[model samples]
Target: MENYHLTHEDGKYKLTKENGERASKVFESNKDEAIKSSKDFIQNQGGGSLKIHKNDGGFQEERTYPRANDPKKSKG
Candidate 1:
């Protein structure tokens, strides 16, 4: 599954998937709603990671869906 990223830009919230350069979805002045939708999209795609970024390109937070769905696993 491709990764999803939520970012705040141009006074709007945008959700972008790894496969595309343009935003896959955009929210009008609502970061919370955009984030929720981004997570739902990743979860629907059989699980993936979501990364939230600040306006200045700083890392905010990351969430991984369903541990089992992560492609990389640590050796026990």
Candidate 2:
């Protein structure tokens, strides 16, 4: 499975693949746009996980796309 992270670096908000040193995509606007873009990209890529960070560089939330019909995470 592909893992991606959205973070702010070099004055730009970027979406970078896990362990990648370079950004896969940079959002010139804001984190929200990057999030939307990441979601669509992940879905098209057959579902994956996205880790999003806030503007201040803090952990925000995570999203997991469904390649299957069931949720991949446990509630407990």
Candidate 3:
């Protein structure tokens, strides 16, 4: 599974793959758009994790695609 990251830089939001490799496009100033784009890319790749980061470089949240890969089981 690949890992995608959502981070803010230079007054804009960026979506990048592992090791800081640039993603397809740049999000000028919208974190929402960046998150959506990251999810779509992960879905297209079959499955992966989207890690959203705060402006301070701390992890905000992690969303897994396909659901099965999630480490914490959801109680029904």
Worst 10 residues of 2 by lDDT: 67-76
Quality of model 3 by C-alpha lDDT: 0.79
lDDT per residue as tens, model 2, 1-76: 7889999887788988999998888888776777888888888888888889887889988778763633547551
List the candidate 3 regions with Cα displacement exceeding 4 Å. Answer: 72-76
- Clash pairs, candidate 2, are none
After superposition, which runs of candidate 1 have C-alpha atoms over 4 Å from their true positions?
Answer: 67-76
Q: How far does residue 6 in candidate 2 sit from its true spot (Å)?
A: 0.2
In angstroms, how far off is 68's CA in candidate 2? Answer: 4.9
RMSD of each: 3.1, 2.3, 2.9
Q: Is candidate 1 or candidate 2 better by TM-score?
A: 2
* Candidate number with greatest TM-score: 2
| Candidate 1 accuracy as lDDT | 0.78
Q: Please, what is the TM-score per model?
A: 0.73, 0.79, 0.75
TM-score of 1: 0.73
lDDT of 3 by residue, 4-28 (tens): 7888888887778778767555788
